[model samples]
Target: MWVFSWMSWRNSLKPPDSLVRKLNRLRRQERPPKREQGAKMGKRPRYHLQGTAFTGIWLLALGFLLFLSPPPDTGRCAPPPTPTAELVVRAKFPAGKPQPPPVTSTAAILVDAQSGDILFSHNATTRLPIASTTKIMTALVALEKLDLNKQVTVSARAVSTIGSKSGLEQGESLTVEQLLYALLVVSGNDAAIALAEAAAGSVEAFVAEMNKRAESLGLTDTHFANPSGVNNTKHFSSARDLAVLARTALQNPTFASIVSTRDFALPPLADGTKREFHNHNVLLGELAWVNGVKTGSTPYAKYCVVVSGSTEGVSLIAVVLGAAEDETRWKEARALLEYGLSLRPRTLLCDRGQLITQLDIGDPLGRQVNVVTDRALVARLSADQVATGTIFWEREARFPIRAGEVLGRLEFTCAGRSLGSARLLAAQSVETPNIDLLLEFWRRGWAPAFLTGRK
Candidate 1:
C-alpha cells in the first residue's frame, strides 16, 4: 500500500517534457551546488532540493521588486482646513452726563472745527439771509484761486457800485492780497463786486461759480444770488451750511489771516489816496482766542454772525443767524464757543499703515506672511463714551500669496454694532517649493532645510 501511495504521488508531481527540459536548462546554468541532497528512502518520496531552492529564489526576487515600488495611496495630500471666525473685545467711552440745553438766537450752531462735530445747535439748519457774512466765503474763494501779489484793475462798473464806500476811484489798481483785506475787513461791497468780476469776469458769473462751489462742498440748502449777502430773494443760507462754509473758508491760511486782522490799509488809489479799514467781526476784540470771521445785519435779514476762535488746543466755530439783536448774536456765539471748548477732544483710533494680522501660506518651506490694513481705522467719541466699545478683526486669507495682495478685512465693532471696516493686505510674499526642489531635499535627507527658512 505504501509503494502504491508513493507511486501515485510521483505521478502527480511529474511535469510535461517541455517544462522538465526548461528546469534542466535552468539547473545547468548554475555554477555549482552549495550542498548535496540526500537520496529518497525506499517506499518514501524524495523532494528535489534544487527545484525548491529555485522556487524560493524566485519568490525572494519578486518580494524585493515589490518593496522598491511605492504603495498606492487611498489618502495622500489633504486639503487645508477651513478658518473659523473669532470674536474680539475692546473698550469704549461711557455715556455722557445729560445737561440742560443753552438758550440761543433764532438760528445758531457751535462746532468743534478740527472734528467737524456740532456741540450745540439751535435751529441751525433754518435758512435765512446771512447778509455780509457771505463775504467770508467770497474772500475765501478769491484767496484760494488768486495769487496774493497778482495785480487787479478796478473796473468802471466796480467803481460805480452802490453801498459801502470803498474809497476807490475809477481805474484804481491793487494786488489781489490788498483787495481781499478790503473785502473782508470793512465789508466793502465794491471790493466784493470787483473781486467777483476779476475772478469770473462778472458778478453774475461769479455768483454762478459760488453756487456751484457750494453744491460741490455738500451745501445742499444754500443759494448764492449775489457775491455779497445783499438780501436778495434768491440769496439765502442756513446757519448750519454757513458754519460748514465758514469752517472750510478758515482752512485756508490766507483767508484766516485776512479775517483775523483788526485793521488793514489798502493800496494807493488813482488819486494817490489810501483807505484804511477796520474789521466787522466784533468778537475779535473781546475774546483772546477769537480771531476773525464776519457779522451782518439788515432790517430784512436781522443780525447774523460767524465767529471762529481757538482756546488752548481746541478750535471752535459758531454761526448765528436772525438774531434778535447784534449784541445778542455775539453773546449766543460766545456761549456756544465756550461750550464747545469745554468738551474733551476725541482721539483718532488707529495710526496709518498698522499691521493687523498674520496669514499662513501653505508653502512646503513653512513660510508665513503678514497682513496689514490699507488705511487707518479712526473713530471720534466723547471722552466718557471711550471705555464701553469693542473692536474685532475678521480675515478671509488664502495660501500662496504675493506681496501687496489683499487678503481680507479688519472690522471695528462697538457694542455689537459695526462702526467701520478696513481692507487687509499681504505684507510679504510666500513661495512654495517646486517638485524638483522637494525631491532633491528628500534625496539629500536634509529635512530641517526644507522647514527652517521663514523670515
Candidate 2:
C-alpha cells in the first residue's frame, strides 16, 4: 500500500507525453539562428543590464515625484484672518483753528473770487486731468475773439467728433451765443469743436491759442491740448489753476449768465422742432448758494467741478478734481464753498489803540515815543491770514510829536495784498528839544532810527 501511494504522487508530478511534445515544438519555432563571429553581434548582457537599470531609474523617479507632491485637500478650508483697525493721526493743528473738511477728491481748492485769495487748498498745485472744465477757457477765448450774434456754420468735423453732443447736425448754422450756451450749460463737445473752429479756423490753432492764453494768465501748472476737455496726456490743470480760470470766467457777464442758466432751448431746427438742454450742475437749483460754473467727467478725469457760490456778499469759487462720483464732486464743492463763507468778513485786523512799535525821536535827551495805530483796520480775511499778516510802516514820525497827530502811514498786508491801513499817531505829546539839546543832537550827528525801529 505504501508503494502504491508513492507511485500515485510521482504520476501527479510528471507531465503528459502529448503536452511535452507541443512545448518542444513552440520552443523550436521561437529560437533564432546562430550568427557567425563579426557578422552581427549576438544579444549582449550589457543591453539587458541597461534596460533593467532604466526601468529601475524610472520607478525611482516616479516614487520621488509622488513624495514631493502636496497632499490632496480632504476637508473644508478655513477663513482668512480678520484685519484690525488702526488709529492714524493726520494733522495736529490748534483745536480752535478751522481744519479742511474731509473730501473724496484727489485735489481741491477754495478761493475768494473777489480778492483772488486762496482760502483753502489740498494738493492744489498737482496737475490732473480736468474733463469738461476745459470749456471755461474755451468760452473765455471765444468771448474775447468772436462776436455773440455772428452765425457760424457747423463743420462736418465738429459733428463727427465723439462725446457729449448737443445734437448739432453737419452744415447746421448757429450763432456764437447759442453755441456758447450749448457748450457751457450742456457741456457739448460738438459745440466746443464748432466754437473752436469759429474762433481760430481749426481745433489745433485754437488749442495753441488756449495754451498761449493759459501762459498769459500765469497758470504755470496748466496746459490745454484740446478745446473739448477730452482726456489726453497733454491736457491737464491744477485745482488752483481751475479756481483762477473760473474766477476769470465769472467776470464775463455773458459767460456767467450762460453757466448760471438752469435750462435753455436752442432755436427751432430746420424741421421746426426745438432742442432743449439743461445744465449738468445738479447743485444749481438744489442749493441756493451755488451759482455759475462747470462740471466735468471722463474715464481718466473722474468727476470734476468748478463751483461759484455767493452768500451775504462773500463770493467764493471751489474746485474739486478727480472725485470718484458725480455726487461726490458736488458735495465736496458745496462743502468747500460753505467753509469759505463761514469765515466771517470784515474781521478786525488791527485794534484802534494797538501799539505797532516804539521809536526814538532823536531828542538828544534819550526820550522814547510810542507809535500806536490811530484807528482800527478791518477787512475780509481768513483766520489763518489774520494770524500771519505783515505790517509795512511807510513813514516815520518826526520830532515834536503831538498827541493825536498823524505821524506817518502804516499799512497792513496779508498774502501779498493790502487789507487796510491806519495812521501812526503819538500816544502822548512830546515837547520839542531845547536849543542846547538840538545843538547837542546836531553835533553828535544823531538821527531817528524809527524806520528800522529802536526797540
Candidate 3:
C-alpha cells in the first residue's frame, strides 16, 4: 500500500513550465564541455534529460502547492462576527439605578457630569445639612456675579468665621480669583464669607441669591443658609441637588479651574507673606482619576464631598453627604463613580420608536407608520438627558412612503452635546403612496421652473 501511494504521488507530479522553458532555451544556446566542444563543434547539440534536476524541479512545484494553497473554508470577513443587533425597545434601561457597591454615605448620588443622568441614588432628595460643600454654590454665585480680578477687603466678620479658616486678616486685600482659590482649595469658611460679601454687598443677600439660583435651577429640595456651610437648619441640600449644583457650577470655566486645582498660593498681603492652600479633596493624589469639586464636614454634617472623575471620555460625578468619616466619603465617591462608568458604553439611552411623537401624511389616503430606526442605534446618555431630547419628524411626508422609508431623524443629546441619532423608518408601506398610474411625470419629477414661471 505504501509503495502504491508513493508511485501515485510521483506520477501526479508534472514538469514545471518554468524549468521546461529554461531547458529549451539552454538547448538553443547549448554549451558543450571543453573536451566535447572539439567533437561536437558546429553541430546541433543533443538534448539530455537530467533525472536529478527534474526531481528537484518537480519537488519545488509540489512544495509550492502544499504551502501556498489556502484551506477551502476561508471566509470573507471572518464570519461577520455575532451580528451586534441594536438594542431596540428591549434595550431601554432605567436611569434610577439602585445601590452601588456598598456606599458608606447616608445620602449619596451619582450622575453624568454633562447629561445629569442619575446613575445611583440613596436618599438623594433627603435634605440634610451639607458642610463646606455649600461653597460650591458660593463659588458659582461669585463667578457669575463678581468680577474675578476685583479687589475684596477681608472684613472683621470674615476673619471671625468659625470652621476651616483661610487665615484672612481684617485689613487684608485679595482678588476675587485669589479668594476663590482659598474658598475651594482649603474649604475656607472665611474666604466663603468674603466672597459672599463682595459679590452681594452682604452675606444675607448672598445667601438669598444662592436660594434664588437654586430655585431657578429647578432644585426643589435645596436651600442655602450661609456662604460657608455652617450647620444652619436653612443651609441644607440633598445629594441629588448637590450633584445638580456641581454640574452647573463646574460649567463655569473659572469655577471648574478653582475646584480642580490641587494646590494654590494666595497673593501676598502688605507683609509679603504668601499663604499656601492645599485642596481638601485628598482623592486627587490618592487616586489617579479623582478630580475636585469640594469636601465638606462639620459636627452636624459629618462628612460630605462632591467629586468628579473620568477615565477615557466617560466621566462621572459623585455626591456623598453625611458620611461617618472623611475617608468614607472619598471611598464611597470612588465606588459610585467606578460603578457608574464601568457600565459606560453598555448604556442604551433611546431609539427612534420612543422618540416618534406623531406622524402626518399629505396623501388623499391618510397614512401612518410605527416609526422605527432603519439602522439600529445604540446611544450613550445620562439619565437626566434621556427625559429631554429633540424629535424632528417631517411636517408632512407627501404621499407614498414605502416600508423602510426614512420619515425623520431623532438625535439624542445631553447638555447641548449630541450623542447620536437614528433614522425613523416607516414600519409598513402606506397603500396610497403605492404605484399610482394617474400621477403625471411632471408631478413625480417636480415642476420645471421655466414652465411654472419666467425663469
Candidate 4:
C-alpha cells in the first residue's frame, strides 16, 4: 500500500496525461466488492499538524513581543506647550534742578513763532482789556479783505467821529492804502471806523466779522466788540491768543511790512496836506532786527506790546501785557528776544535725494541698489539733545527698482523714543535679462550673439 501510495504520488507529480490515464484505467477495470467481514477503512486525509502548531506558536510569541514593546509615536495627538512671557522696561528720568521763577506780569508769553513753541507764560490765557492792539487785527483784516488801491470817500461819519484822527475832512477822497497807513501808524480811531465802514459797510458788521475770524483761528478765549479796541467789557483777548493773531498777521507779508515801518507818509490830502505818522512800537527803532508790531495802553489795559524779530536765521515773537511802565514792557520784550536768540536751533538729519540704505537684487553683476529720500528731512530740537536715529529697510522687497518708487522707511529716534519717519525711494531704475536671453548668452559666444541678433 505504501508502494502504491508512492507510485500514485509520483504519477500525480509527473504530467496531466500520466495521472489522467491511470485514473481512467482504474475506474474502468476495478469491480472488486467490499468483503462484509472486513469493512473497508476509509482513508483519512493526511494533515501537517506539526506545521500548523509551529505557525500558531510563532504567532503567539509575536503577539507577546508586540504587547511588551512601547506604542508607536504617531505625534498627531499631542497638545501644544504654553508660551513664555518676555518683559521689557523703559528708562526713567532723573530729578532735574529747580528753574528760576518766571518774570512776573499781568499778562505775558514768550513764543517761538515758527514752531508755535511757548517757552514761558504767565496769565497768558487770561482775557484782559486789549486797547489799540485791537488795531493790529483790524488793520490785518482790512488788508486781507479790501483792495489797497480801491478809492474810499471820507463820509461825514468818519470825519465827525470823536477820537484820534488823521485830520480827514468829510469831502476828502483817499485810497484804502493811505487810510491803512494812517490807521496803523497813528492809531487813528477814525481811520479804523472808516476802514470798517468801507470794508464791511458798518462798524457793527466789521466787529462781527472780527469775532468770526477769531473763532476760526482757534482763539477760544477771545472776543471782539469794537474795531478800534475802544474801552469795552466785551473787547478782550489773552496774551496767547494775541500771539496767535500776531503770527497770523506776520503770515501776510504786506501786513508785516506795514507793521514794521517806523515812519511812513500818507498820500496828499485834498487840501494839499500830507499826513505823517510815527509808529508807537518803540522796538522797531531801538533793536537792529526788530520790525514793526503794535503797542496799546488804556486805563484798563496797561502798557502792552507785540514785538517780533529775526536773528541768526531764527524768528521770535514776544507778547507782553499790562507792563508796570511803558519802557518796562519794551525792556522785558528785549530780554525775551535775546533769550530766544540765544537758544541753538536743531539740525536737519537728511535732505532730498540723500542715500539712506541699500537693497540687494538677484543680479550677478550689480547685486545691490541704493534707497534715498525724495525731499529733505528736518526736525526742530534743542542743541543739547542728541539727534541720532536709524534707517530701517523694508523686509519684503528686493531691488533693482524704478526711480520714485517707495522702497523703505527711515525711523528717527532719541533716547529710545521714536520721533518720526521718512519714506525711502528708489534711486534709479534697473533691468534684468530674461531666462531665454541668459541661456542663449551662456550657450553661445557674445560676439556671435551680437552679430546675429533677432529682429
Scored by lDDT, the top model is 2
The TM-scores, one per candidate, come to: 0.55, 0.56, 0.57, 0.55
* Model 4 / residue 15 / CA error / Å: 99
The whole-model C-alpha lDDT of candidate 3 against the native structure comes to: 0.71
User: Distance (Å) between predicted and true CA of 354, model 4?
Assistant: 22
Ranking by TM-score: 3, 2, 4, 1
lDDT of 1 by residue, 1-455 (tens): 65566445434533346545856765665434344578443431123454556556434433443333222221122343344333343335347653524665678888878768888888878888888988877887677667888888888777777656567666768888878887888888878888998888889888888988899889877899888788788899898898899899988888888889998787665567767777778889888889879888887788888999975346778988888887888877887776665464344444456765555544444456776667765544445443222223244334445787776665655434455666767788754343333434443554234223422
Cα lDDT over the full model 1: 0.69
Error of 2 at 16 (Å): 99
Against the unseen true structure, what C-alpha lDDT does each candidate score? 0.69, 0.76, 0.71, 0.69
Q: Each candidate: how many clashes? A: 9, 0, 3, 2
In model 2, how many backbone clashes occur? 0
lDDT of 4 by residue, 166-209 (tens): 77777667788888877877888888888999999998999988
Worst lDDT 10-window in candidate 1? 68-77
lDDT of 3 at 278: 78
Clashing pairs in 2: none
Off by over 4 Å in 2: 1-96, 345-455
Clashing pairs in 3: 117-383, 117-384, 400-433
Superior candidate under TM-score, 2 versus 4: 2
